[model samples]
Structure formats: structure tokens, C-alpha cells
Target: MDKSHQTKAFRRERVRVGVVGVGGFGRSHLGAVESLASAGRAHLVAVADPFREQHVELDSRLSAQGVAWHSTLEEMLEKETLDAITIATPVPLHFGMTRRAVEKGVFVYLEKPPVPLLSQLDEMIAWDEDFRVAVGFQLIYSEPIRFLKQAILDGKLGTVRSIRGGAAAPRRQSYYNRASWAGRMSINGEPVFDGPMTNALAHVLQNILFLGGGDAWSFARPTSLRGELYRCYPVESFDTSCVRGVLDTGVEFAFAGSHAVRDESPHTLEVVGTRGTLRLTGGTFSSDIPGLELPQHAGSDVPMLASVSRFMDYVCGQPETDIIRLEDTRGFVETTNGTLVSSRGIFPLDARFVESYQVEGDPGLDVLGLGDLITQTITTGRLFSENSAPWANRTPTVTREEIQSAVLEEWIFGAEENPKNATACL
Candidate 1:
């Protein structure tokens, strides 16, 4: 082909992508793509949903827009040669789909819960960095969250003393009822309830680890818990919770989430240091110590956008500054894992209840895998399952090795580099 023809072809095939699952979140993903793709920011190549007939809007729009459609993820994978995929499928399918795509050399913009098993995560991390894998832990991507992270790295708050955060959101039975995997321990065969710590509150915890810890937060220590804790139908998973925990550096963090509430309150936090404090409300950034408050927005962008953009930029080989490194997420992931253990009384900051409650069998769910799996299980029944963690009751503890590996990964991903000096990343 001539140079001009090749250029035209490049333009024609600019980063083909596929989205699996078309539930509310899937619909949101499609909408975000539409906004960007029409402006040439993305190319909406195809979408897959087993219930295409139920979603008249999605079906008609895709058909009318000339975007191809598939009834199942495997079908989409086989029929369309895509550069990347935004998985909107169940959590159980996450590992399978993501592993397949990356092994096939396709970039993957996976939803939260990027497979919970550390072993699985390590294997995925082993993929050629050439095939980028971006997780939807979007607290790092939130404009306000990012700004706060900058503030922490700037040392405006001094050595971090503690983190206190809570996400008070509401969910109806309709939420789980509408989706097969909803509120279950596993959908198909994958474990569900990656927990509020990993799912709804993941964005919050991700921010805390990145902004407060200076990207060296691989170390994690779960403190303790309190209040209204119960797993709903599926009774096998947590439905509502409130817990208190502390990080390795003695920074205390709290979690409050419930599936029974009728209304959703704000998800916010206050990061306090000896010098001052930082506050985040609805993903907005502000700090009393730094003396800065970012322009607040009326609403936060869907968490997926930040990660999606990150995936795209990385896939295009954008400069390091733009990428959300894996190491950064390691802190986030560790922090999340800590919360799960803490909440369940498996790992205790207080140690008061260490022997009070008999913890159940190990779910051994990777928090990330659980979140994606929960999302998937909730969205679909027969997809997104991973093996349970047999050690849930074994007491949660992080080896120095775990934290080190997470930090090392973040360093490689530029999460630990001085935010201002992106080039110094590991």
C-alpha cells in the first residue's frame, strides 16, 4: 500500500475496541465512548451482551450507529480482531477474558477487581508491558483525587498521620434482582462480594494509598472494625458494613457501606497529617494544609473513564506521566486486601476482637478479582468465577515481601516517581 493509503488505513482502523456486558454500567461505558469516539477520541467498534433483546436502546443504537454487536464475549473475541477490549462482563469472566486478550497481545481496560488473586495479578503483570493492562481503580483518575495525590506528594500535609474515609451509598434489592450475580458469593463459579472495600469503595482506598503514602504504601496493616455488618442475599456475601482500620504508617482509615440503604450519601474522606488535613467529597480534592481547593464539580465522572483513558494513552505509548502504573495499584490493592481482613476480624488493628468472633472459612478472594467478579456475578449468573480464598479465616497479614512487590510494580508504573518528575519512575 502507498504511504497515503496506509495512513488512511491507520485512520480507518484506529484502535478497534470491544465492550462486554451492556447493563447500566455497560450502558455508561458505551455513552462515554460515544462522546469521545464521535469527536475522534475513540472508536466504538463493537459491544457484547447476552440480553441484547432486553436493551432496546443499546441494541438500536449500536445497530444504527453501524457498530457491530455480539451476544456473548467469546463470540466478540473470536469474530472481531480488536486492538483492545473494555470488559463490562461479570467478574468471573474477567480473568479468562483479560488473560485471553493480553495473551493475544490485545490491550485490556478491565473494570475494577482486576482478578483478586495476587498470583493471577502477578502473572498478568508478567505480560509484555507492550500489551498494556489498565484496571478501573479510578480514584487515581478522578480530577480531584489526582489533585489530592499531588498534594500528598508535595508534602504539604507533612508525614501522613492517618486516613479516615467512608462511602455511605444505598442499593436496593432491585440492584441484585436485576442481575443474576448480584449479592452472591459467586456467580457461575466465581466468588462475589469483592466487598465494599474492593468494589464501591475501591476508588476511595486507591486514592488514600496513592496520595497519602507517596507511592510507597505497599506496607499494609488492618486495624479494626465496628457496626451493622451483614452479608445479604446471596447471604454468602457482605451486604452492609462499617469498619475501622489503620495503615502501616499508623494512618487510620474507616469504611461504611450498605446495600440496604434507600438513598446514597456522599462518599468522602479526610486525610490528616501532623501539619494539616486533606478532604475529598464526591471525588473533589481539597487540603487545609496545602491551602488549596480544586474547583469542585457538580458530579464525578464514572470511575471507568479515568482508567479507560489511561489504557488508551498507555496503548498509544503516551509519555510516562499519563500512565497509571501497576505499582500504584499495588498499594491500592494491598490497602484493599487489608480492609477486607480487618473488616472480617481476620486481621485486627485493635486485636480486641481477635478471638471474640469465629471467622468463617476462607473465601480467599482477591479483592480486585472479587470486585470484578461481584460486578460480573451481579450482572450475569454463569460468568466471572475464581476459586475461593481458603484462608479468609486464617488471619490477614501482609509480608514485607507483598508490600515490596506492590511498591516495586508501582515504581515501574511511575506511581512512585515524584508526581512532578515523571521521568524518574522505576
Candidate 2:
């Protein structure tokens, strides 16, 4: 094709994209958008962030790129001509902001745990039928995970029996201190329950759900759940969580995660079935199935950039399929909500169990044997309570209705129905 024709074709396919919250994780989104724009897959037209002034470097960079900046998402939505918007805002702000963008007829690429509450997730799911929406469960789009998903469907694992997964990673105090709602159980009566399961190891949980159902489009909803939550630091939500549940399909699921571990362990998910077992951790896959050959791969199993580019393609109607769907996250979301409801309020650990550390001049907390605790939970398919932990309370029997009640409490009342003894998290 001639140069003019090629240029015109590129312009015809380029999607006009804006990013909200151009700081912290939002900066990562900006980098991806900018990369795509340079390649003519997208046009980064605008950026929105209330804290743009605080991030002078990010502000100047966007300005140099000729992208307009707005203080709030609403302002950006009103003033900018955008075909799509990527939301990397706070947990509580996700649903409302994404809703506004969707209502404006703009596609959305939202950050993880799409929204804090199940009710909000449901609303987004309903709106998804009419809008192009992609959540940040980016691992689903990774080549390795995609290949493994296909293997499961090919009966590589036979009839799946159970799944166990865990992520034990330490976080500095700066992580919680980053925002007013960070590590909070609720902010001004609104649920902002951030913690290990929903934030750090959340991708692991989502990957487990995807594996349980044998595909990206058929994630399994938890039939029931029992778990324990703990906070070793002075936070509102639990920094450590161990949960066990059964999927509606009768496959067992158990997960444990902690932000209080001393060292970062490779986040792992193990799928056990009648025929064989498959384990995935840190992009390494191993299986015991006879004749199974693991693919040789390098680079990240995390597919954030790929997901962003694919989302832009999806928005432009070039890719007719959604590699990641908002509805697929419902099972993970409901199970997380059920964990919160089934547990007695978050239990703060005795100070003796917590040791202080400093990471690059930032304060952090480490729970003694957090790694062991998580591993034990995964191995035994039990929660901390089920293992006879000295600090854990007996997990309550939780009904799906109880889960809905907790969600409704946040929707109507905005905070935990009973928050007196709850520990903050993230």
C-alpha cells in the first residue's frame, strides 16, 4: 500500500483512549497506552487524576505527550472526546467511575477487583452486555494460562478434583499509607476492604477460578465458604487470609494469602484431578500427567500490557471476542465476599507475633511463620481456624444469603455492619 493509504488505515483503526488516576498503578497503564499509541493501536488523548499535582513527573510527561489532563474523572469524561477510558482509581471509586464512563458510551479497562462490593460488580456485569468492558484480571490473557486452560478442556487433568493456591508477599507501610482508604475496612461508612485476597494474590485466585471451570468463559461460583481473617498490624482489614470452599460444580477450592510474610514466595496454584495434577507458579508449569510436556517460555506470565492492547483492539471492534470478561470475575468476587461474611470480624494478632521491619526507609510488618501458615493451609485444605491457630476464631457457617446480606449492608449502610473489632487490611 502507498504511504498515504497506510497512514489513513492506521488513523481509521486508532482508538481514542483516556486514563483516570495517572499516578502509581495508573502510571503503568499510561506506559502501556503510550506504547500502543506509538504503534498506532491507540491514541492516548487525555489523563485524569485528582492527585496529578502530586505527581509532577507524571504530569510533565503526559503534557510533553500532548495529552490533556483533568483533575477528576467526571471533568475528563465531560471535556475529553474519548472512545474508551482505563480506570486505575481506588477500589471504592471503581464502580461509580466506570459506570459513568460506560454510561457515556466509552469502553472501559478497569483495574483489579473491579469493585469492592458484589452488588457493584453485578451492576457492571449487567452493563457489560452493551459496553466493551475489561477487568484487570490480566493473567487470564497470558499465553501460559491460556495454554493451560486449553489443556484442561482437552481433559489433560481429567475430572478436576480440587484446587489449592497461595500468595505470601510482604508489603511496606508506604503501601497502606499511600491513600486515606488504603488498608481500610471502610471509609466514611463505605466498604474499602482491601487485603491479600482481593489485591496482592487476587490474580492467583482468579486464575484458580478460571482453571476450576476449565476456561475463561465458564468460571465457577463458590457454593459455600469458610475462612479466617487476621491483621497483625494496625489496619482495619486483614493482612492474612485463609479460605476453603466448594465450587457449585462440587470441586474444592482453598486459598491462603498474606501481606505479612517475611519473604515473597512464588504464588502457586495446584490443580488436582482424578488423572493427574498440575502446578503453576511464577510462570513455571509442572504436571504429573503421563506424556505431558511443559512449554518452554520466558518473560512475564502477568499479561497487563497485552491485556491493555487487546482491550483497545476490542474497543475498536477489531477483535470481536473479549479475552477477559467482567462476569467471569463474579465467582471470585462472591467467594471473597463470602469469606468476609463467614469470618467473625477481623482479628488483630497479639503484638508478640508481629515483628517490625524497614524497607527502603519505609516501615512494614512481618508475621512470624506467615509463610508456614499459608503453606499449611494450602496443604491441609483448611483455613487458619481449621488448623487450630491460637489467634484464630472459629469460622462461622456462612450461607450465600449471608454473603448477600454483607454486600447489601455495604450497599445500603456503606460500612461493615459490625466493625468494632475489625482489623484494617491491604
Give the candidate number with the greatest TM-score. Answer: 2
TM-score of 2: 0.89
Computed on alpha carbons, the lDDT of every model, listed in order, comes to 0.52, 0.77
Worst window of 10 by summed lDDT in candidate 2: 1-10
What's the number of clashes in each of the models?
Answer: 26, 7
lDDT of 1 by residue, 10-38 (tens): 22324677887778666666766666676
Candidate 1 has an lDDT of 0.52
Evaluated at residue 406, the lDDT of candidate 2 is 73
Candidate with best lDDT: 2
Model 1, residue 160: what's the lDDT?
A: 70
Query: TM-score for all predictions?
Result: 0.70, 0.89
